[model samples]
Target: MLIHRIFQVVTVIDCVVGMMASGFIVSVGSTDWMRRRKLPACDRILICLCSSRLLLQGTILHATLFPELTQWNVVRGHSVLLVLASTACLWFAACLSVFYCLKIATFTQPCFLLMKLRISAMVPQLLLGSALISLVSSLPFLWVDYSSHLCNSTRSHLKNISFESPTGNNISYFKGFVMYVTWAVVPLLFFIASSTLLIASLWKHIKQMRQNATGFKDSKTEAHITAIKSLISFLMLYICSFIAEILLGIPSCQAMSRWKHNICSLLIAVCPSVHSILLVLLNVRLKLAVKSILLYMKCHRKQDSAEALWQERKSMSSS
Candidate 1:
């Protein structure tokens, strides 16, 4: 019970932080898009990714804060939507990685050149396709037997923090495994392929640049390094989340008694939260926006302090 309470608090804090970060990204991107009257393809993907993350974390927050929401009918619907949001997030990430690779990776293949030329134009279709795939993956929940297998809340100990159980209904281990394979795993594979290609291209470019007599890093090298860092971080966090989700989807695991499975859910909750902040930092536009915001806050605080000090001195002189 104590461990459950602790994990619950941690999960809540993680969700809150994630929501704030995701919200910041959405606000910044929306503001830029509206001001410019145009949206870049990369910005489009990032905004969509953050939006999906917002929905995903919000749903988790709703379930955790309101335990009774996991009762029966509500839980099944929530579970369906939750998985959908997660799948969308995964797909969006894959799209983002692919976009970065195509835009940054130096490739001479005819297919690669063709994709690079058209990737920007294809973003909208890619996003739509990802959403459709997620919808398809989620359809199984609606088809499953919710009356008996899913609605049985009696088996749940911790308001059923995990979506599925062993009975294989609205929620089962076998179904969860299948969904992960069909939905999450596919995007992960795509992401890996793109990231690998990007890395190889970056390495080759760096080696060529180093061969120059100067032997000094230039803007291109720095850009390559940054891209590699961003891609590596994304890969690491995504893999952590993938593993965590598989643990949470297990049916037989008791969240209360089995800290392993329970903690994995917490990991899943934390991933988006942590990664949202990371994305903001690694992105040039987002990073600049954050710096300006921080500067403004600092100046505002100083102005407030100066005003308070003036008022205090005036009062003293009057006295």
Candidate 2:
């Protein structure tokens, strides 16, 4: 019981931090859009990614963390919606990875150059296409009978029992496989491929610079390195989250202690928020915005403290 409580507290903290980081991305991007009356392609993608993640995290919190507040019927009915939102979040993150690879990685191939030239114009369309694909892929879950079963299984071990009908069981397993492939495997492949190409491009650039005796210390090189590091870190976190999601589906894991289950849920929930923070750190504009906000808050706090101290001193003198 104590462990469960501790995990609950940890999950709440993770959710709050993750939501705040994603919210920051949305606010910053929206502000930029308002100022320019049009956002850059990257900022537009960031806004979509952040908004999806924010909604995903909120839904996860309500569905997993505060299950009592949500009736079983509501949870069952909205399970498809939750999956759709999460799918959108994952797809958008993958889209962002692809966007970065296209924008930052240099290639000598004509196709690559053409893509680089056209990527900015293509981003909005790409995002729309991704959303449409995610929706279409997720629509099957709505028709699949096993969604309610999965939802109930998450809440209790009773629903994890085998179905009497082998045909139903087979169909459920098939649907599960399809969902895993579409939601996890597809995005992972895209992320891995993009990361590999980006790394190779950066490596080649570094080697050429070294041959030219330019060294590898320029701002551009540093930016490339930072991007590579961020991508690698996000990939690692993504893999962990993917594994956690898989494990959570297993009956044995669901039968475990509540704390153990909560731990897996926490792992899955934190990925988007943590990745957004990494994005902010890697992007100069976003980082500056976060820093400015922090500095303003610090100054405001100091001013409030100073005013309180002055009032105390004045009251003492009058007394």
Candidates in order have lDDT scores of 0.82, 0.75
Mark the regions of model 1 whose C-alpha exceeds 4 Å error after superposition: 146-173, 253-257, 316-319
Which candidate has the highest TM-score of all?
Answer: 1
- Candidate 1 overall lDDT versus native: 0.82
Candidate 1 Cα deviation (angstroms), residue 237 = 1.2
Tens digit of per-residue lDDT, candidate 2, span 25-104: 89988988898899888888889988887877887777656655433346434556666667777777688788889989
Candidate 2 lowest-lDDT run of ten: 162-171
**Steric clashes per prediction:** 1, 0
Query: How many backbone clashes can be found in candidate 1?
Result: 1
Q: List TM-scores for all candidates, in order.
A: 0.87, 0.85
Per-residue lDDT of model 1, residues 1-319, tens digit only = 7887888899999999999999999999999899999999998998999999999999888877886554446766777888889999999999999999999999999999999999999999999999899888887776453333232335543434443333444454466557656678889999999999999999899788867749565887788898899889889999999888766665553532347745887888898888899888888888899899999999999999999999999999999
